[model samples]
Target chain A: MSHSYEHPRPALAVDCVVFGLDENGLQVLLVERGVAPFKGRTALPGGFVRLDETLEEAARRELEEETGLGAKVFLEQLYTFGDLHRDPRERVVSVAYYALVKLSDHRVRAATDASAAAWFRLGDKPQLPFDHEQILRVAKARLQAKVRYQPLGFELLPPRFTLAQLQSLYEAVLEKPVDKRNFRKKILSMELLEETGEREEGVSHRAARLYRFDRKRYVALEKAGVNFEL
Target chain B: MSHSYEHPRPALAVDCVVFGLDENGLQVLLVERGVAPFKGRTALPGGFVRLDETLEEAARRELEEETGLGAKVFLEQLYTFGDLHRDPRERVVSVAYYALVKLSDHRVRAATDASAAAWFRLGDKPQLPFDHEQILRVAKARLQAKVRYQPLGFELLPPRFTLAQLQSLYEAVLEKPVDKRNFRKKILSMELLEETGEREEGVSHRAARLYRFDRKRYVALEKAGVNFEL
Candidate 1:
């Protein structure tokens, strides 16, 4: 059966720029197109929106089907891309989303509609088809700007992490080295991190202390108009 | 002309919540729908996306056609609403935008597809149709949260405004009583405002000195990662 509309409608879709971080730097997830239009070429994990699901639902579903990412990752709508010639076949309006995942937990594989799923270092990703490059650029800018105001980097780290790990997450996302002393002072001053009384078990040099993000306290402070800039 | 697709497609649209601030408080622009499927009901100024235009262009066109807002307002995409049953006629996915306009310069009149256009107080808006009430709520939350981290409140004020007007903009957006001394100190410390050497005119009260928002300084500070939290 075919669906029809009285007026012409552009094809609606959802695309995601999944960012993961580690000691090296930031990375993004990409899937090879298993079918036509950009056949066998790499692109962000996405597909046309189904009428039965919400935009976020469609986004999560696409991420799961294409990249094998779990549904529990930190996902947010980044922006909407509506270029007339974005898709070679027709006019496709894509609602773009950005997701942050713990790199260690993301075991990617191509499933359903893709031939392969892989992570590429942020600056060294393959040339993407369509307007996906612009989408990725916007997502990176949003992530970099948002890191100063929101604690979204926590989603890219382990639950209990060291100050070095937290600081490195910021450095990786912001793509700049920060003064260690000032970074620690500002993060600790916020009092949104709780020392977990646990230390790194396996380390080369010294066992750095571990800390957990105090989300409830952060929420309260945010409500009280506290600044979280670094 | 009718259009057919192999797969079902959700109709896409662009809606704008135009915010204007005055001595009283924040207000939103709404237009009475002249077409069917919510005819005669007041709603955000919006219309369906044309295949030829970008989403932002669609939003600007809808605002112009429905509310007669100029093209120079500070407009930003707020969020996308894609609930399964948001539209009774069909699945209509709306990319919502929020705009800040100086109230003193606004002259709203219904045009094109709308019967009337008017401003309503933020908290005292009339019954809205097609999930627009929820859209308005989201727009308000975004405005309140965004006012702290960015200098968006300046868009709602005239180019040369006094400290009292600035303070009132914050108070209105945040919906809270801010300490006057602290607010003044914080705002002044940022140096994003330049003394215009002008004073309020034709006022019954004492004339207050006017200052202009320094956009160049703000862009520089933002690029340098300066925190503008109030």
Candidate 2:
């Protein structure tokens, strides 16, 4: 409801922290601002939530308009920031969202609205504006925690991936090396992966069988509270 | 940054899903509405955000004003609700806050502005206004998940409690019975509790030693990524 007081309303904005996984490690999508505020600074892709759409829709639209990403992807609300003076001009409350996508599948290309949009290793991201660095940290923690309890880690992997690739995704997100035998035993015991009878084509060493996350079982187990710890 | 679209600005409100633990089990504070829209209907304690106050401040103030609870309590931003038709008179975007308080410390007393304010067992709570039911569910799940990693669960327990009481708190929140031996082993290993050199009174059987949570150690261990899981 509009505040019926003397003070002005805080400007509401929605920002997207897009996460992608690649051969190097976990990465975050960054866009160089083209606006007056932090004109040249690189930050999470986002904009004001328009009157016509919901918060999620605004995030997706902003992601698409700023990074050429699509709405038909995994999107979850990370948190909302309303600390006074977070923005220099006025009180701006931002609803932050975190998204996971396969870097191999959705390549980053600068959109017309942004100076540049690129994927940077999360550990090596540039300084962001308006407490975005903290927002990104929360998003990363959410991703790490969610991966251990949900099959959502697959969102950062290709449709068909090796068990090693999946394991690496978990390691990269958790920021800790997992015991190979223990990780495999725990994950395989979940019975949520489907072997496609295919093997890695370009690797020189032993070929690992390609597997896809079983969406049906993943949803069922998610509802049943099955912790998918790596 | 108000929207320039044809529609008028929607009203914004803040609701609190205050959770407290007592002999009755997990409970939430509810207030009977005194205004029109949902007059006399029992709902979450909330009100319109003032122009000068931040969303959090608004939440905290509204919570206390409507329930007679004070600040400096365990409060966290739960989620935002913005369904267009959720509010009948207008489109009200609510920032919901979830608070954990020891029921023994602050008993719910009807506020001057509320028809009545009281504690209701979460599972037996009546239908709340707007999407408060959904917000309450999210609040409970967040509490359950957070209890594993954060020491905030102690907010729901008495200042001095027995091992059995502590274990029962975890069981009630987690909704799963835990082995007493395992529970005691894990919790005592934290070394974050101080024995009061006393035991629970008024019990017919053996009295258990009472312990108080060590806030200093909890704050330190929290930074070290120590989790208080069952």
Question: What lDDT score belongs to each candidate, Candidate 1 first?
Answer: 0.89, 0.82
Q: Write the per-residue lDDT of candidate 1 for residues A35-121, one digit (tens) a residue.
A: 789989989999999989999999999998888888898999999988889998889999999999998777434323244888889
Q: Where does candidate 1 clash, by residue pair?
A: none
Judging by DockQ against the true structure, name the best candidate.
Answer: 1
lDDT of 2 by residue, A1-230 (tens): 33342334556788999999888889898998889689889999998866567778889999888888877779999888887878887667888899988788666353333447888897787889878988998998888778876778888988999889988988888888988898888888999999999999987898999998899988898788777665
Model 1 spans with C-alpha error above 4 angstroms: A107-114, A181-198, A212-230, B108-114, B179-198, B214-227
Off by over 4 Å in 2: A1-7, A108-115, B1-9, B108-115, B202-205
**Tens digits of lDDT, candidate 2, B55-154:** 8999989877888888977898988876667788765677889998888877735323344788889778788877778888888888888888777778
**Error of model 2, residue B70, in angstroms:** 0.9
Question: What's model 1's overall lDDT?
Answer: 0.89
